[model samples]
Target: MRSAVVVPETPVKSLFAYPLLLSLLVGGPALAQTATRDPAQIQAGTYAVDPGHTQVGWRVSHFGFSHYSGGFSGVSGTLDLDPKNPAAAKLSIRIPVGSVSTTSAKLTGELKGEQWLDEAKYPEMTFVSTKVEPVGADKAKVTGDLTLHGVTKPVTLDVTLVGAGVNPLNKKVTVGFEATGVLKRSAYGVKTYVPLIGDDLQLTIDGAFERRD
Candidate 1:
């Protein structure tokens, strides 16, 4: 009789198998709606963007003119997903470009005019994260298309888990994350050549999402 042969598993197979096993153990129950407890809800909860607590700002040089700094106000959004399967997530953010403030009224108006934002035509900008990749325990990379001035472009953001806990009022477990990214102004069609403004505009986004009740 010939001896039975056992095939050796490859490292990639083992790595993928580990997640499957883990899902079978942890995610299985979390995913099983009828079999398990009610899946958590991600809407119907109070989520403050914490303008004083958060930041969505950008900087650009003026023809070597000078450094200009400004940030967004009235930030808002909703985060929906399975904490167990964070990749199954969705987010939305809206910003008013008209509200942008600069050190000078002249600069602010210039930024909002056709030479830059063209606020008359594109008054608002938005972003909705389409994909989320887990970096570690509470860190992730959020990838999505950002729309600005009638143009949409794919962008990647690095996110950090700020904190998560149960909200007393809403009675929902909430998770917080801070996401950041940067982009060139010209890429989004914001091209206003000036003696002072630099083409390389630095965009910084800090997003903190809360799980809904």
Candidate 2:
């Protein structure tokens, strides 16, 4: 028999590294499965929204010459998802209206004030889906009631499933989606500048949710 080679153990940097390492080891198999897993195989259940990973942005025409964009900072929600029966999936999201931010602090304040979003009076905006219509394998049209600026209106979003997999750091099954829609701010009673600032606003949503045990 050949002589046995001896190996030295490398010490882990910190106590925090233990869970991280374990997560990678345990999550490896799941991560691999994600690539070949069909959408129909996605676990059906309620997933808790990962607030830190969610974003909602809005773009509007600035003076008929260019487009400007801004976004809200805080978002929370639950996604009731069923992969086999995609039409059964539903979404409920809450947006803190006061979290609106742009390139300038002054503009941000103005947006929350009466002339724009009037967030002082309406502190939050929300969307609750009434129906989800699958368009293709990984896309859908989600219709819902959007409550913004104290006005409620029906809005439909073209949504696409971005990806789904086990997060190696957290070891949780995560799903991500992107959505886009348009809303007329004037219909929501925020017609400040009208044609000058643009009445129609484009909304974009990017969010991820982790499966809840």
Candidate 3:
């Protein structure tokens, strides 16, 4: 006669715990995904600008009564960065002049005409950084040549590192920055109405860059 074989049964609590533990292990990184402003976390490499996530905004005083604002899209750029040597960073940016948009349709059309930006003559505006001076752990002064409206001028942008991290959706390393500068419209030969439309233009750039590899 042969004895009956017996099988050990799994504990009820362990059965529920197994799947829960597996889920935590698999989703831990996604659950903890976040961008940080720490300069030490910046990765050293070449990054291409994320045009869909970058924008350039400009504001000017309208007849000294109120501020008028507009923005440019379709921005493209590249950045070579080294966290250990921030000063050695290089940047290049391109902006399509025709992408300028404002609240009013008529005003937007006028901005693209010969009287204002004259996009027909100068189809693109570009900036190439000449120097990068770190001011703080996450701040820098970037001096570059800004070519706009058929003219080029030296402009200094106060740039702040906003965040650096791996993008959740694409899993690519990404960095973000905010830059501000003031430029005289007349200096770039975009002067249609000097004092009337405000000669000084306040520029704010929101840039996002993703690592190439």
Q: Which stretches of candidate 2 lie over 4 Å from their true place?
A: 1-37
Q: How close is candidate 1 to the true structure, as a TM-score?
A: 0.67
Cα lDDT tens digits for candidate 2, 1-213: 899989976677664568767677677433344522357756778998898999999999999999999998679989999888899998999999998999999899999899888877999999999999999898999999999988999999999888887877778888989999999999999999899998889999998888999
The candidate that wins on TM-score is 3
The candidate 2 region of ten consecutive residues with least summed lDDT is 28-37
What TM-score, computed on C-alpha atoms, does each candidate reach?
0.67, 0.83, 0.85
**Would you list the rank order by TM-score, best first?**
3, 2, 1
Tell me which residue pairs clash in candidate 2.
Answer: none
What would you estimate as the lDDT of candidate 2?
0.88
Q: Which regions of candidate 1 are displaced past 4 Å?
A: 1-54, 63-66, 166-175, 194-196
The alpha-carbon lDDT assigned to residue 175 of candidate 1 equals 51
The lDDT for every candidate, in the order shown, is 0.69, 0.88, 0.94
